[model samples]
Target: QSSNVPKLGTCITCHGRDGIGTSPVFPNLAGQKSLYMVQQLELFRSGARKSEMMNVVAKSLTDAEIEALAAYYEGLDPGK
Candidate 1:
């Protein structure tokens, strides 16, 4: 992965270190299906999933970045 990707940093703020969200309002991304994570990220990027913060955050990600993020989160163990 490249050091230039920003979504990883942006994600940690709400989704926590590895996509285990800080609270109920923020859904846990860790252990989620990779394709599902990609879909939601795309939706947020395209404004289909209406979230002011996510819309802007997702918009900043490229397709490669999205895929990388999905894979990163999907690989996490939710139980941890």
Candidate 2:
């Protein structure tokens, strides 16, 4: 239930603490629609999205971890 730690350690590096992404190539996760994030994460994990890096990372996530991460990003404020 508590996924904050994993999100910080695993996501913050490229996604940024605010989830706005470190650069233009990385999409902003903050305030993104939850369903969208979930779907995308699932695709990434399943190797359907076709990103080498994402595939590797996403494949390691458990379902709970994926949901928790999506929820965390969905709750963030990109404008902040």
Candidate 3:
């Protein structure tokens, strides 16, 4: 994983270290399916997804970073 929670630039702004979003507009990333996150992130990187914020963030991420982030988020306990 090239990226860690602390190393995350924009993600940590909305989705915190625990993957829980700080605002209602930001969807919770905790315990989400890794594959789903990977797919969505890939789409966001490729401009297939239409989130202005996500696109900018994903654009700077590598494949390994994306997988790492997805795994990290998926492992978080939403019930926490």
Evaluate all candidate structures by whole-model CA lDDT and list the values in order.
0.86, 0.82, 0.85
lDDT of 1 by residue, 2-27 (tens): 24545688888889876788888999
Cα-based RMSD of candidate 1:
2.1
Candidate 2, residue 75: CA error in Å? 0.6
Each prediction's total of clashing residue pairs, residues at least 3 apart in sequence or on different chains, is 0, 0, 0
Task: Itemize residue pairs with steric clashes in candidate 1.
Answer: none
Give one digit per residue, the lDDT tens place, for model 3 in 1-80: 42544346668789987788999999999899999999999999999999988998899999998998888889889989
How do the residues 1-80 of candidate 2 rate in per-residue lDDT, one tens digit apiece? 23444645677778877787898888888999988988988999999899988898999888888888888888888789
